[model samples]
Structures are given as structure tokens and as C-alpha cells.
Target: MSSLKHSHLYSYHAANSRLASFAGYDMPLWYKGISNEHMAVRTAAGLFDVSHMGRFSIKGRDANSFIDHMIPTNLVKVADGGAAYSVLCDDNAGIMDDILVYRFSSDDFIIVVNAANIDKDYGWFKQHLDGYQATMIDETQSIALLALQGPKAKAIIQSLTAEDVGNIKRFTHRRVALSGVDALISRTGYTGEDGFEIFVPDCHVSRPLQAEKVWSQILSDFATWGVLPCGLGARDTLRLEAGLCLYGQDIDGSTNPFEANLAWLVHMDKGDFVGRKALMELKDHETRKRIGISMEVGGIPRHGCEVLVKSEYVGRVTSGSFSPLLRKGIAMGYVAERYTGEGTAVEVSIRGKEWPATVKNPPFYDPKLYGWKRVA
Candidate 1:
């Protein structure tokens, strides 16, 4: 394989992490350790270098109209400076990628997408822009993204800026100065925690130096706040415990929002959007549903493990891990609709042996114990 592209934080990760190739980027798999980083984000704060995710700016007279027809969610419902989580879909309602749309105005917005799908998503956007007057600019390489997450996230971030981060509210954003860098701070995260995702622009100019400077400043400022530098390994386990879907693992080209238990993102009533017709048709005919499962026996479940119902193969695990917070194996997978109810019994094949498991509605961790609710 060819050498992987490196993020602006490559130097820092190289010095501190066990590196691995992911989505064409050389990313950190772990720093101190997965379990250690996971708990740090759960109890205190953790900083994640998520600059690899694709970032785009869409602006034009017809931006809102074009965006409304592209995703399932109602863009009109999102006020200025607010964010909405939605998915891009093919004509058949199959998910292309889940994305977060940040509305700066009716004619201006920013989209953050999974790194692996950047080119594909950019193509999709261009293909459908034939009649729209919007201009989509790929800003992926021009910015560095960092996620400051956990219970102490707000406190740490607030100390750096005069802006009241406490008033940001969830799913909202503001342009502010962090230390000395101008940044767009959003009250959003994937770890189901009260946190902020900071976007620092002009990263491509100075290369790694600009990114490294900001990253170092944050860590140094909060050195005593128990903020650990996290990696993708902990990110996976944390998101799993929160029951959040991973792009390729939990939801992908073959999965639709309905089957993935993300029907809430679809605004059926908001007339006319790509995949609306197909999604409407599949709404009542979903054969399988995504559900959470927790192991009763001690064993870690992995992706592609068979899920059994009464000794019959019912489904396969899409994402699983040994949840550090729960002290047991937890997973999310698609199973027959009949077996999706909470308290349903099932068995997961772990290394050719069946382990007792039970189905439950996600998130596996209680919102009150962790996530946005915990900090709110």
C-alpha cells in the first residue's frame, strides 16, 4: 500500500501514539491505552484530533434549497448557528454517510462528513447541483479539528475564551478566539458527552506548526485538568458504549436510517428530498432493526460475529467492544424486527462459542450517567 496521508497533528501523534492507517490517514490508534483514554473522557476530559474528517463550505443564493433536497432532515428547522445531524442517501434510501450540517445562515453552511467518504460525498453533491446555484467548496485540508470532550470540557474551554461556552447550548456554534487562534466552536460530539468540537482555519498555510501550536496550548493550559490526549481506539469504544453508530461498521451503503434506528433524522413531512420516496416505502417494511446487546458472559464480541436466536442465525454484529465503563462486552447490530425489543434474549458467537446476551434499546450507557445529559 502507498504511504498514508498525515494529519496536521502527525508529529504529536507520532511521538505519543501507536499509529495505524485509517481512511487514507496515518492516525493514532492509542496513546497511553484505549481503556485509559476511554475512562478519561468518561470522567474528566479528553482531546481528540479529528482533523481527518471532511469539512466543506456551501454558500450561494440557493444553498438552503439545495441542501434541503440533499438530506432527509428539515434544514429550515435549524436556526442560524445551530447544527443538525443528518445522513446523505442514495436514490434507494441506502445511507451514503451520516453528516453534521452547521447552519451559518440560509445561504451559508458548513458540512462535516466522515473522512473516507469525502470524495464520494463531494461527487454526490456536485452531481446533484445541476440546477442549484450553490457553490460547494472542499475545506478539508484548510482546517484542523479538535474535540474536547467529557464533563470538564466546558470548564477547560471556557477558561481559554471570553465567550460564554456555557451558553453555547447543544448543537449550536459560535466563532470565537481560542488562546490566540480564531476558531469555530460547536457544542457537539460523538461520545454522547457535553463537549466542543473546535475548528481552526488556516491550518494548510503553516502545515503542522499551526495545528501543533494550538494543540500544545490547549494541553498545556489544561495540564492539571486531567485532560488526556485520546486516539481512535478509545473513540470507538466510547462511541460504542454511547450506542452511536460508526459509519462503515454500524451504518453504511446498504443500511438506511430507519433500519439503523435513526429514523428520527428523517423529516418525511418536509416534502421532497433525495431518497424520500424510497425511505417512505421502506418505513413500514423494515425487516431488521438495529439494537444494542450486552453480554451476560465474559467475552468480547467483534464485528461480523453471528447473532443467534434460539440457535438460528438471526443477524450479525456490526460493532462491538469490551466497554470499559460497563465492565462487559457491549455491541450494536441489526437483528430481525421480532428480536429488537428490550429484554429480548439472544446469543452472540464469540470465537465459535455462544455467549448469552440480551437486546436493549441504545444507548447501552444511561444518558444521566454519561453523555450530554450528564453535563447538562
Candidate 2:
């Protein structure tokens, strides 16, 4: 709305991408084109400048206590160099922001949050830190993140660092040097395809030139692998195809982890947490379910479209798009619990008409042919 904040690679993006204002930051929507970038990530590889997301460093004597108090997951089991997808919840167990927690040790950790929730999440984090001996530093500006995703993601990083890229298993991270600058490489991505999220941080007070160098080197060195610089448009499509939830759309302030079908991330037996009491009550009391649907015989469903069954309103579409990979309209939305069963008949209202659709568990693209599980 006002002057937009810029990432370190803003200049590069300005020259190469079609820029748009997203989350109060000037970000790329497409480079060559949405379809071109989307297909590249599904087949070969795609690089994304995700520096707009919030990055935080948490460290101190009570770091574990502070974090474990906020999340329902048992942080005790998260080994050093391990990471897990978790959420920040309100007292009522309502979703505030879904986040990724990376554990380096008992007292050192990294938390990555969505771009739009930076200030809100940070303020909440500080309030919760009052009793704990730890400190939370907002490193969103200091760190530059590049998500190199697709089948060939590992090979590109392997060529840069001496570390065994294969050893960094999924949900694990390691310190590696690339383009002569140190970085933290994590084997996690939004795309269902196997890939890595590389974090490049500035050493001195000045802005990080190393971040730009690393970004350049990956594109120049791996031209043969067909690595294209992607934008948020492709990122959204790939994540939806992977069946992953976007914070604001798929899950929001009113959504709980269980209702969003993220029960696996909640550790009820892990002892007390901020929302543990409320979540325990919500466990089996869920009246709504987050369902993925596919449209074979209608126009592309958009957010806010009404979901119906037999002409009765059931819910609304949260995130929807024409799947670039599956070649059909796919979406994720919440509905009355009874209507969420797999293969259940549903219809989405677009404009004034209802389009025939069905509730299907996502990775809307077939797993046997696409995704990390499929043989490349």
C-alpha cells in the first residue's frame, strides 16, 4: 500500500521478472511466464527468492522452554539439525501463523514464518518470551533465502559445496559454503518435489553481496539442468499441487491444526502448551474439515466461491487455481465435516452457477507419476 520493502535481489528481479506487490514487498509474479516457470519446477528445477519470508534466531538458556511452551509438538524429539513444520496458535488454538522450526541444539533454533505475518508473529513471540531466558532476533532482513526445488535440486547444490548433499536427508539442515559464502541448506520445500531451501546471511553490517553472487552462480552453472528463476505465482501452484496448505488461504486465524487436517503435527502427550487445553477439547469436536477438490467439468474455482452439496451451501473455497501440472482446476477448502469424505460429490459456485466437483485428497497430481515419491 505504502512504499514497498525490497529484498536484496530486488534489482535482479526488476530486470528479469514481472514484479508485483505481495505482503508489502515488491516480489516477482512471473519471469518468462507462469506456465514456463511452473513446469520447470515440476520437471527439472526452479529457484525462488523467498527472502521476503520472516526468519528469526532464538537462543538462550530457556530457548527450549520458550518454544515448547508455544507449540504443541514435543521439541525434545527434534534432534540437532532437524526441522519440522509447526504452527503458532492463539489461546483458543486458532491458527496465527504456520511456521517451520529448525533445531540446532537445546538452546539454538531458527524459525521461518510467512511474509505477511512477520510483525504480528514477532509481537506475539516477544510477549511469550517474557518468562523465558531466551531472546528472539528478527533476522528477516539479514538473511536471504533461495528455494531451489525440483528433481535436479540436489545436483545443483552438490556441485557448489563439498558436503554430501545426499546425507542431508529430508527435514534436515547443514552449514555449507556456496559461491564462497557460508549458508544453511535445508532439505525442505513447499513443492512436493525433492529440493532444498538455502539460507544466506550477511556476515558484516553491510548488505549481503554474497547472497546475490550465490543466486547468480546457481542459474549460470546449472543451465543444462533447466533451472529457471520462479515467481510467487509458480510457488503457489506448485504448493497447491503438493497438497500443502498456505497460511492465509488454506488455514487462517479461525482454523485449528486438527480442522486443517494437520493432526500429525500436534503432540497431545508432549505435556502442556499454549493451546493444549483448547486443542484437547477440539480434537474430536471438529465440525468442519479441510478438503481438497478437483473440477473436471467446470471453470477454474477461485477463492471465496461457495461450496455446495445438493444445492445446499456447505462451505467456501479458500485457495483455487488451474493446476499447471494436472491440467484441471484444483482447490483446498473447508467444509462441513460430513461432506469431507474422499470421493464425495460436491459443487462450487462460480459467478452464479454451480460447477460439478468432487472432494479428493490432494497432491492433486497423481503421486505415482509426480512428487518426490515417484521415480524420476
Candidate 3:
């Protein structure tokens, strides 16, 4: 069997002219193309096959305590059924990976990590768990994941399942039934929109599901929803607009939460955790800061491009894109503290050309996306 093949949703995406290739699995690039698909989630609704995302379930007597010590967020604050964004950090406080930790019970938790970081993350967990009594299992291959996003997302998903999804608060999850399939429906998404991530077992094949079947059925069911299949391009633009960080781009081993503008996810109040001392030291000592920038001049900025203050090189662009809503090139990067305010004049070097830019607060679009309000 070829290692690279289309996802279960492959034929559905192909019918819509979606570009596809191996992405952990054969995945769609765009169905109606990038522009149209991006606009759909911005204005109405869109569905995504996020089955490629990796999930690990940790369970044992020491699971909760063990995981809390591994990440930089205050896991104690995560209520049962709620999720918290966290960073797995090294001893020096450098990020290993950014992930979502779901506290399902005192002894059970599910961690969702990036697809590319799955093996590495699991390895770290295995090594660290040896001293503790917790058992960590890689459940990535067994679950199908889908994200339904946009202002209409709730309404469309509610019609398919009778799980009282309306009562589920943001970052919280509930067990629901979708077209007779039981699922773990989470009110979470990467698009920065009001959305749900449905985790169904791959074996819900008209019988008790074994988790693996839940993942496959999601990709196989796109035809029933009339959803415009989305690809990585749309995923990037959507997250950028929402001011969410992309791991490899916005954050990495060398990037700290403070420099990535993700310090909110780091809880200094939480008693000693991994990288706590370093993160605390960074907080007390003033240094560089991360900020969002919007180009006044008409042009697209790209990763690794230079951000200049006058004639001096201050920093480099981490992520940039043409804002469909703002109608301008927008970017995020690290700049000196003095140049970190909105309206501060800056320049971005793009392909040997300097483009006029300004420091602005993210997200580039209306902040309403975070509020889940319908765009007018």
C-alpha cells in the first residue's frame, strides 16, 4: 500500500476541484480555491477534515499531576470538561510545542497536539512518564476530527446532532450524538470563529465505536453537509486573522511565549512547573516583544522577511498574508519595545523592496471573530 493516498474525503474534495496531496494523509488544499474558501468561513460556514491532528489520551493515577508538571499553563485551573492552551517547554523555557490539554476527569485527560509534532511529543511524554504512574497512549490513529466554523457553524452543527451544543460554553466539551453517532463535541477551533470540533470514533459503524472509526466517518461524511472542503491555506489565513499562533512559524523551540505574545497562556502564579523559573525570569526582566503589523502600502509580506525601523533591521516577519477583510498586507513579528505600539511607522523588506507598514493590534480583521458575532 502506498503511504500517500487521499483521505476518506478525497473524492468529495476532488469533485469540487480541491487541490490535494499527502498531508499526514491525503488532504484538501482548497475546494472553491483559497479566496472563496477563506471567505466562506469568514462570512458563513465551512467544514474541515482535521483528522490528521494528533491526539493522545493520558490515564492513570498520576496522570493529572504528571501532565501539570510538563506544560507551562496552570492545569489546576482547567475545570473538568474544559480545555486550556499550553506550551510544552524545555528546561531553558524554550517551547517544545504548543498544545491543547483537556481535563476530562481526575485520572483522564486528552491532549491534542500538532500533526507534525506527534511522534516527538509522544516520545517526550513517554520519557517523562517513567517516573510517574500515569499511562499515556497514542490515540491519534483511532479518532476522526472535524471542525465546523463560522457564525453559522453552531446552527449547522446543531441541526445534525441533538447534544444541547448551544449550552456548551467555549473551550468546553460535551458528549453528543450526530446523525445517530455519539461524539465528543468540543466548542473549540483554530479558525478564531465560533465553531465545534467533533471527535467521533472510527468504528461507530452502526455499532459501538472503538474510537478509530470515529475519525474516518467524519472525512467520509462531507457529502452530507454541503460544506466547502477547506485546505491548509484557508486554515493559515483564518488563524492569522484570529491572532492565533502557528507553532513552526509563530513559535518554536527558540521562541518563548513572551516573545510570541502568548504570555497569557503562561501562568506565573502557578507553582513551580517545567520552565517556570526561566519564564518568570523573562517576565521580570524587560526585553523584546512580539507585535502585529499591517502594511499601509499595497503588497503581501512573507515569512523570514525583514522588518525595519528606519534603516536598521529590528526584526523579521514570522507570518504575513493578504488580509481579505482589511484589503492590505498584514504581518506579525518581533520589534523593539519602543516600536511596539499601533500606528508606529515601520517598513517590511519584501523581495528586495521596502514596503511601508504600521504596527497594529491583531487580529487584522474585526475582533468580532473572537466574540463569535456574525460579520455584517
Candidate 4:
């Protein structure tokens, strides 16, 4: 078997965690417990070492052009300090990878991609960047990223960063100082909560500013504020509960942007892109579509489980898990476009038995909490 890789924060997890091999990294699945970690973030605050996520920096005179050709988003209009959810597509409009594009300036931008798709996305960027005066840098190793998420995220994060975290609008970013450490703070996250994803230099160990400095400060400030350490397990469930899609599961090479209910990410009016022709044709009508479903049955649905409509195979669950917050199984997947609707009764086949399922409005949790909010 291949040896497991380690993140820059590996030592920290080793000190306190139930480490597991996930996406080839010896990552922490949970430290305390999934429930405890989940509750910690829901009611209080949680810190996550998301360094396993891919970070790519694209810079040049033609950086915008290069990205425009590669992604379906309108890259030119992305104001400095603003961000947008974007996805890479193939010649056929199939999703190559869904990424978060954080624009720092007109010519400088950072993309956060799934950990497993780092090499795949980097390769696609390299091959498709022809003629653009762009330089793509994979800085995954040079950065140690941390996600501070929860109800009290702002109070905890603002205590360390000089830049106003409260003023940073949703889906925007800025360079700021965190406990004297120069960092990039973005009002963004995967979990459905108010949070900041801070980026720190990996090589800088001296706490004139360091990871520990920011960590300790955030912890101390949030002690009464209710902040704790969360792991990948809680992260997964939280995102799932928020009705977010995972790269390999809910979306992949076979899933087109239109079919994945990600049409908002596709900008057909943006002149032309990699899969413009194919995507434009399907823009008016898509045969299959993605939807969120919450199970009312006793059994929990899992990924790859068969989905049935009237006892006939219709689709399969892509991302599924028991939501601790909701006390039921929730999932997202693709099905015949005709079957995508609220209250559409369905069935999920798990193990050897079939269980009842139904389509529900996404974000099993409160929708208002999913967006950014000011601390009261």
C-alpha cells in the first residue's frame, strides 16, 4: 500500500485526533467526536486545518483571459477583493472541478480546489493556458490554511486580525494582520456558518507571528465565545447538511454544470469558453438534473446507494449522511429532470433493503444562517 501523506499541521493532529487516511492524507477525521465537533461549530466556533485543500495562484497580464477560457464564470467583472464560485469544464461541458476563485486584484487570484483534484486541475490549467501570458503557481505546500467557522466566528477572528472582519462582505477578501502575522482573510467557508478562512505562510514559524500565535489568540478570545477544534468528519456532514456538493460525489467528469443545478456558475454570455458550444445547446433544456433529498425512512442513505422511483431505478445517491442537526438522512444527487421537485416521493436502496425517501428544499438547516451575518 502507498504511504499516507501529511499536511503541515500533521503534528498538531497527531497530538490530539483520531487520524485516518482520507484522500491520501493522514488527516484528522475527528479529535473529540463527530457529534461534539459538529455541535461545537454549530453553537460556538471551530477551527479546521484545511491545508489539504488545493491552492493555485494564477498571475499575469493574461491571467483573466486564461481563466475566462478555462472556467465558465465572468472573470473580468470579479472586482478586486471579491470572490465567486466557479467550476472548470471539459470540451463537452462536463465539470472538471468546482473551485472557489478569490480575486485579490485585477491580475492576481487564488483558487481553492478539492484536495483529490489538485493534480488533475493543475494539469488542466497548464494544458489550456496556451497563448495567455499567465503563470500558474501551485502553492498548496507553501500555505497553511485554517477555517474559523461558527456563530461566534466573527468575534473570535476579529480579535486577532486588524482588518475589520465585520466589514468584509460575503464572498470577498482582504490582506490583513492576524496576531501580527501577515495573512489573507476571506469571509468564506464550506460549512453553513459565519466564518473566515485565514491563509498563513507555511515557512514562517517565528511568532513575531506564527500559526500557533493566531491559534492561541483565537482560542483565548473564543474561550467564552465557544470555539473548538473540528475535523474532516464534521466538515463533511456540515457541508452535506448545508446542501453543498462534493467534487467526486455530487459532481464529477460525467456531471455537466447544467445538470448539476450549477447553472449560476455558467456564464453563457461571456463570449466563449472551453465547453461553450455544448453547454449553450443544453442551456435551454437539460434531460437529467440534480436535487436535494431528505429521507424520512429509518435507514440512513449512503453514497452509491440506488435511487428508485416507483420501484424502478431512477438515479443514485452521490452524497449522503445522517445530519446530526436534523436527526435524519440527507443527500444530493442527479435524477431524471422530470422527477426533480419538492415532495416527490422516492425510494433509496441501501444494503439489501429499500427505504422511503423524498425531495425537500435544500439546506435542511435555516437558510438565513447560511449567508454572512453581523455579530449582534
lDDT per residue as tens, model 1, 1-376: 7588888798899899999899999999999999999999998899999989999999999999999999999887799999999999999999999999999999999999999999999999999998998999998889889999999999988988998888899999999988878889999998978899999887872485666776898788786878899999999998898889999999998999999999999989999999999999999789999999999987899999999998899999999999989899999999999999899999999998999999977778887878778635
- Candidate 3 C-alpha lDDT tens digits along 1-376: 6566444444455566556554456677776677767877776767787767778999989988899989877787788899888889887888889998888897999999987788989998887887788898887766667787877678776776766678888999987777677778888998878888878755321332433333334335543444565787788888887777888888889888887778788887777778888888888454667788889887799999999988689888899998766677888887877888889999999999999999988767766443275443
Each model's lDDT comes to 0.91, 0.90, 0.77, 0.83
The regions of model 1 sitting more than 4 angstroms off are none
Worst 10 residues of 4 by lDDT: 201-210
Clashes of 4: 0
lDDT of 3: 0.77
Query: What local lDDT score does residue 231 receive in model 2, on the 0 to 100 scale?
Result: 96
Clashing pairs in 2: none
- Candidate 4 runs further than 4 Å off: 202-209, 368-376
By lDDT: ranked, best first:
1, 2, 4, 3
TM-score for every candidate vs. truth?
Answer: 0.98, 0.97, 0.90, 0.94
* Tens-digit lDDT string for candidate 4 (31-56): 88988888778888899988888999
lDDT of 1 at 110: 93
